[model samples]
Target: IQKLAGGDICKGRIDVYPKTRENIQVALRVSRVNQLLGADFSAEQIKEIISRLGLKVEAAIKGGTLQIEIPGFRPDLTREVDVIEEIARVDGFDKVDTIFPVASVRPVRIALRQTMLRKIREVLCHTGFSETVHFSFVECEQAENYLSSFASTEDKVISLKNPLSSENDTMRTSLIPGLLKTIQNNLSKGQKPLKLFEIGSVYFIDSQGKRVQKTVLTAAVLGPYELTPWKPRGKEYDFYDLKGALDNLCSHFGLQVGFPANANRSYLLEEKSANCYVDANELGYIGQLSPDKTEIAEKVFVWELDLQKLEKSLPPRPHFQNIAKFPETYRDISILVDRQVTSQKASDLILKAGQPLLKRVELYDHFEGKKIQSDKKSLTFALSFQSKDKTLSDDEVSPLFETIVQTLKTELDASLRE
Candidate 1:
């Protein structure tokens, strides 16, 4: 028991016995109902509306006024305004006047990443590569050997419990393995040297012990893939061919990309692989398919990019640079480097050699045939030199070019091609 405030009497709680209860009455006025609802209803109409409600309600008009006895069952009809609502509802809500609201800005859901993905596909297709798609599920044993973990962990793959078959027992951790399968399927159907690309998700576990996934862009070219039909000089798709397409893609998006010197990967052949990066974040890697992982009787080069990382690298706004209005000087320099050195390494060294004024460095041709030394290959690059402030002459630019060649000579033991 608790004492009452400033009183001698005390109050105590008790469990009360339950019993059946009687109905309570509520009064409603017709004029008050009309004033609140803005719905002028006749007394006869009110009676008819109540009658239509299927209740035996005793409703009538007496002495130039309307009367309605609220039903004890309708707890909502405790107020006269509620009585107005009932009449309006039974009559039809269309009777109420309609009003137009002032228009405001509406949102059209435009996914930027998805839009960019479509553009990437468009660029590749325009570059003579057809887009292809594959199942996220793959053979577990096959995927285990080609796993590329997003997070630095060994136990990163996600396997399915009720997979349709052993082939679909594991979710894909890399796109290259599935892409290789696609290539094999195409080859079996008499389609050789095909250029193909895929944009899809690769699933794995993150560092937080949760399922994580990322969208990746993977491309492959197998056999004697040719963009030009010049039959006299049938060209096979090489590392630089795929690299050229990717470079176009990066230029289209206005992104500055970097390829690392070394990418010793399981699925790629030695001396033919490099990891791509934007800023400090590793985007993905590109290389020739290792012969051991493939049974197809052709040369295959594949590239994959973690588009999730690329998406994050997008700038919120664009930056504009004035095109060099002065006449540019183009230099064709072919350097013969060791067989073990990759074009990307030589390119990096070239960029490092040509500092501020080296506007562009593009590879036009690469050869590794009989005329070239047994242990050396030739790479031809078109170096463009220009300045915003002045027209660069060969006399002024030769020193810098010589410096680049000298650096290559000292660092890579490179020599100018005869």
Candidate 2:
């Protein structure tokens, strides 16, 4: 082409491109070529291919790496894979074997925290709550209102050193505010019966005065309990509905948890909220959102569990218990206790008093009106008595029932209701 152009385009040898520059030298391994192409090409064949392509090919060193000097014209051939491609092109693409590359794969061990996160997501999804994701930022006022409860001091709001905007200047200390915002947004669009959840980090300063970020699982529910063909507007979701969802989650993880009294938050209705616990440590809080927090007319219930604490609270691999071959005996017991005494405390007392024979304890009824004393409340529990080896007889369960009643009366000053 230069000769036809009749210009000094190729006068003498203009070394515009460096032929032997170190930048153009690429190391190639015969094994790597075969590994990539899934073909067993010999070193001799690869070397011959490079020579034919007008590129310099050094003899293979002890490590089987051949130093191939790329030509100025073939500037693209700067890496081992590039030479492998050239070999594949010259060796006839059809001749390259079509086979799975040899590899040794091992199962990747997943972190337990990650596993729990995935499981929590699955459980929440199965429980009819749609998952939501939001930015880690919130307004300064919302952060102060919702997050002050989590920090030991009021000014622990974690502000961004360089935030994107004035609106999202601070990290969220609690997921409740975000969930409330979501509820408001959804309600504005005429979406009803909102059941939503989020699993993310909440930032705060701990008692030790260190900035901390914790993973939290939070869920919110509003509107009807259930929507059905028969009842267009089903019963509105009460505190128990939200509690039942928390119970469902606890049951799934085999976590032995309880709702202790007076788990209050500034935004939560004091009488409708309780602190959840695993052992003695506080796990989280669940309550009815105070009406003042939102413009939504219907009541909203939400629960936020410290996922970090929850991960620690998760029970060990449960040992399989054989299905009971014998029948279970049911007993009804109603107790009169002071209004201040929690049903959970009574239930725990009953479990302790009726151990070994007490298979289940369920609170079926709670009354506080004229049917009970003014200063006290009545809690009716359906107790199940069962033995793993044989059916429980009335004679065998009577002593335990009496013991439970006496224990409650002695320990909690609770009397068996007539």
Candidate 3:
């Protein structure tokens, strides 16, 4: 109805909309015979040529040549070539020369952004993650419920006014819900130890009252990642296992990954989840899928990342350095701190104090046993110290390591675990 009201009469092409007037009008300046056909001719010759095309020739132009108004029905009459073609139609096509067009091909380099994304997908696939794809359109209930963590009130979901079915009536707000359903279906089919991924779009409204979409990469793991022989004991897939996959992905592109300073307070996690970021943008969240959100009996660890944001955050040029020639001095220690104190805090302090020679800090173990305080947790880290020019000795590595341990003790009330 809107198309008809707007005067779209052509089947595929949009017809001229005569909103301001009852009919569309166009002016066509009749060029000289020399300009039109590359041949000199008199006014009468031009008029005679136009008269042959059934157009009424009017007064002369500034150079004393014929100019006339083109009819609305003749939409093709706008420029000199158009007029020349009409003249040619009355003239002879046999006289015009025809030439075949030439074709050329050149190889082009792939864009860095696209190359980065391709490498990401390849890395994930190589890490035993099978890619899954699904319909972009989804149920309204799905869209409203599985909104992205970064969504705001303006990020309204888009729903088709006329839909094929309720199952696919609206655009998805995130990919996790679909991925969860995929996991569920796989489990029902007796497929366990599943690791799946998807790269797709999530649709939402922008602040300017327009619909927008963001591309994301989402992955999920269920059951055990490795099949073990029938045994009484075997640990299932955990959050770190999924995180390790993601960490491995970021490392491929030289992308930096970080987590919030505090445990997520916005239901990101009560304990097991942490929001991941690249260059301060909340790319996505990696956490355990809550039971309420799924019927799958086994635990599921999921990671959702914004590949578009990841592309934007990639450095223009990646830095490369040779491995340190001197062997690294290693230190492993366990510190007891309040449960609320994040491991990131301790790691940052270790990096800060060990700035001159501290090579790397890694959390190797975490424990909250019966012997430990109820309100506190035991965190273990592996610290590596190295010097570019000389070997780092125990005398040099110990004091730097001890200074960081003391900083943790003073700053977070952390104590070295016996």
Candidate 4:
């Protein structure tokens, strides 16, 4: 009986009972043996042993006899001694300890890339810009019309075969259209003067005909510089405000920028915008809201910097230098040229000819009159000169200024006025 209940041996022969309660009579009959032999065993303990031997055993009193129910899985656990053995084995589980293992320690710090992104987010937050999260999927029409050069048939885009709506059919190619649409949606909800930013992935075709992904940081400001219900009048955002924000961002990375006068007109305002460049490579664009684009966001000014390019271009840290110890020499040259001549051309000529002494050149005035030639105008420039070793004098600077004027005159057919 012990061998069968302890799973040490299989029962060689088993007796079949006619009634269901007959198994209980057989179990009680085996328990009498343990009692008569002076072995410590209870009816409950015997039933537990029977359960461990893969049999369902139940006890009940009917006509003063202990009845039992035996399930079909275990014919070996026929008697009460078989049930008692399994109970004794399982009772040892109470001696086992209950405790958890200790975990290992982790180093304290984030990865370098994650740290950089956090700093970028903090900088944007400090500048009154709220961070926004958007889904990659965007409306097809908005993606094509608002985002520049997005193609619907491009395999790079993970399109939805069964889209829930037309608005969420195609994956976003750029962050601008989604942000602008968000601004428009907020405006409809009575939110104004929205200043928002998003840093996210943008997928596009690269020069090598492979699909490339880049992490971009984009920002937009719409409506006024200041909002007040009581005042009812505010200064609207313009190109310079957006340019200043971009300058701040680049300054954080210790970069110096020059605004070229010639900016492409297709995607931005030609007169109020400029393409950003670093080391002669075009970085991005900052511009005022073109009148046509202003339909969605009135008086909006936007700036987007390529984070991939900026990350590669940013110096580790910034350094400072002492201001000039010597006084600067100034030269003013007025050139009379045809109205068709651009300031960019005149500036380029001055820079190319001035060479060694020209520190800076700025156009101060532009005028046209009846006294001048019918097709000509007057353009004035202020040129600054300084030497690292000593202060420059008129004699040392005038000759170089003359060469600059002569170059403009010969190259652009410009003439000195006064």
Candidate 5:
């Protein structure tokens, strides 16, 4: 038998594998066993059950406790709960009374951030942008190039220690690269009116060399604005289409943001791009992609925003208001301001100066023609006025209207266009 077991019988030597049972001792308490099983189990009864299972039991250091030594064959008997389970098994589980666990039941709530993200997704989907998902792994060079203009020179892209491939060795610092690739692929497949968005984590290494990860919302619109049977060659999407989609998202969240001209992004057209902000906190940027950088014949517009910052800027849950008892009257004003003066600046001034009575402001017209000075532009805004308590007479609106006009003139040097 020894020879058959590959033992050196001729040398008068044989190795008994697993020479002794493993020395695993578990302390089983009488009170704990009774409490768990809901049965009055004395220490002697537990010891008798354990001994029946071929386990050696000894008196534990503390009274009413037993030290149980588990056999190598009974590998499952390593914990005190295992001993209790065995006692229950030997004593017959049918004897144990059925008792439902007691716990406080409450309705599960969806987290606020999660709800916010879902709303963002819903708004973008309704605004004609399709959501996309891409691998977090990105090309090192592509990631670096995208982060270069926005991130400081000291900041770097986080690289993988054990990369699957050289091409995807680094974590993405921006979602734009992946979305750009998606655009290229879809365009190649002849997909038109392509609008895509993604909500995903972007990785970065701060100036302090700490790896940082953040959630960002990125969206892009390309191809035609819309396809119509009448027009086989539809109008291509422009900067406004991108901004309008962004506005839809912000409006849904009750977030008011500003777009000031920014020339920092290398991937976007300097003249076309603007930085998005809520007060002084910068949320992100929106603009037309630089044709040379994107290498696409058709124009592409995109925006990327920090979702955390966006969440911070979102207004509280809006209070319900009854429909106005009175009618809303609108007044139109066209102002001629210098070419460099943004329409947003003029609109903000109007909103501030025309408050209390001014309910809404809409820039309905923007014209730059031979009639206007070469260095100036024409902007027309429709101001809606309404009173909650009473119908607003022209007397009430006229003064606010003149105040708005005068404020625009004094602050922006804007001349009221006849």
Candidate 6:
């Protein structure tokens, strides 16, 4: 091997029989030195040491073991330790230590906000709602059409550079679009009266033209409000169903939710279709889909809440109280008013007027006819009155009732029916 590797002494031949023992001793010493240094010993280094004695050495591999083929001129092949050192060096650094320290273990604590969100989901589920998960990415066209205020150019959107499809190119700016798409998909699959909700993140452009991520809880319900075997018997979902759902959610969270009359209009709904509110500073909206947009999803109603605001507003846990023990007083009042005036306005007027004694106001009847003035309609409202600390006599409730009626007349130009 030394001769083939270009070593000088291995170029010539000589007798090695006379000095066999001395050659073996020299080989053992060379192997010890190589092992201590832990370096790969080149054939040139070995041949240089043996050349002074006019000997030749050659390396050979046979039967998976390295052997020294001693030429008659090289006598350094007589030791086993030399072969062992050569094998160890050629095998590389597999013997090095690589063990590391063990990591510490600890229990993970769930966030209070996340726990509240889970509770909300459970409450909805118990109320016959199913949880849904929707993709954040949606079509640019759908986002533009469904969302109230979205960034104009698709390039300004946080869009996928390599989108799977044109329909999934831009990140969703609002949950309504995705929820409607979900309804459309289920409708195609023959599913009806679907009550579904999703709690997840949505992307939008902020005032500074930066993409912002906001967590939101949104729900959509469509088809008949009540299922029935008889054809054309059930009531389709409408604004009232959505209002009830919102009221239930607010009650579950111990939040005070109120809908003031003449609230802002949503892009998705008409004047009679939508209502918006500030639930203790958190804003929310519920409404029927606008007729044109309803073509994408028939008879659907939806609502959305800002989850960050909701988290700030939600109670940490639920509390319970016993029902009122005292007898409750009830009163009914009817107002003949302009058809342009919304039920919400009348309800608001009654509530504001009733003040301390009023427990609730509900509109139960509405009438419109030629006998009724063309510009006027009649609305009947039920009012419940109760005092928390004491049972009230008829006289005690009478004055407050009169005051409420007078206030309605003064504020809303409402007149009591004869």
TM-score winner: 1
| Candidate 5 lDDT score at position 411 | 99
Selected candidate, larger lDDT, 1 vs 4: 1
lDDT of 2 by residue, 318-390 (tens): 6577888999999999999998888888998999899998978888788889977899999999999999888
Tens digit per residue, CA lDDT, model 4, 1-418: 5656665555596558764443333435445635433345565665666566555544564443345565655566566666444454565535334556568988988865676688788877887889888988788765555344232244345456888788899767677777877888999998888888898886655445677666777788887766557434767766656666777766676776666654554556665566677767666666665757546748666766677777777676668878988988888889899876766578878977987778787776777798789899898989888888898888888889889978997999999996
Give stretches of model 6 more than 4 Å off. Answer: 1-109, 149-156, 228-232, 261-266, 316-325, 364-378
The sequence of per-residue lDDT tens digits that candidate 3 reaches over residues 313-354 is 878888989987889888897999999888877888888988
Q: What is the lDDT of residue 83 in candidate 2?
A: 88
TM-score of 2: 0.73
Question: Could you arrange the candidates by TM-score from highest to lowest?
Answer: 1, 5, 2, 3, 6, 4
lDDT of 5 by residue, 1-418 (tens): 7657766446665558757666787888889999899999777888888899999987553788888888788877778898899899999999999888889999989988999999988888887789999999988988888885346678999999999999899999889888888888988998877889999989989999888888999998877657567544657777876887788778777777787657487888876788998888888898888888777887888898988888887777875778888999989999999988888889989999999889888887888899989998999999999988998898888999999989998999999998
Candidate 6 has an lDDT of 0.69
Which residue pairs does candidate 5 place in steric collision? Answer: none
Model 1 spans with C-alpha error above 4 angstroms: 1-95, 98-105, 149-153, 206-209, 226-233
Misplaced by over 4 Å in model 2 are 1-100, 107-110, 161-166, 188-190, 207-209, 229-234, 294-296
**lDDT digits (tens) for residues 221-314 of candidate 1:** 8666445566335667788778778888987777877786556677687678888888898888888887878876788888889898888887
Query: Whole-model lDDT, candidate 4?
Result: 0.69
Clashing pairs in 2: none
Report lDDT per candidate: 0.78, 0.84, 0.77, 0.69, 0.85, 0.69
4 against 5, candidate with superior lDDT: 5
Q: State how far residue 113 of model 4 sits from its true place (Å).
A: 4.3
Model 4 / residue 138 / CA error / Å: 1.0
**Alpha carbon lDDT of residue 345, candidate 2?**
88
lDDT digits (tens) for residues 132-234 of candidate 6: 8888889987666545532334424467789899989988867777677678888899888789899887776655777777787888887875555653566
The collision pairs in model 4 are 24-68, 49-83, 50-83
Clashing pairs in 3: none
Model 5, residue 265: what's the lDDT? 74
Q: Which of the predicted structures, 2 or 6, would earn the higher lDDT when compared with the native?
A: 2
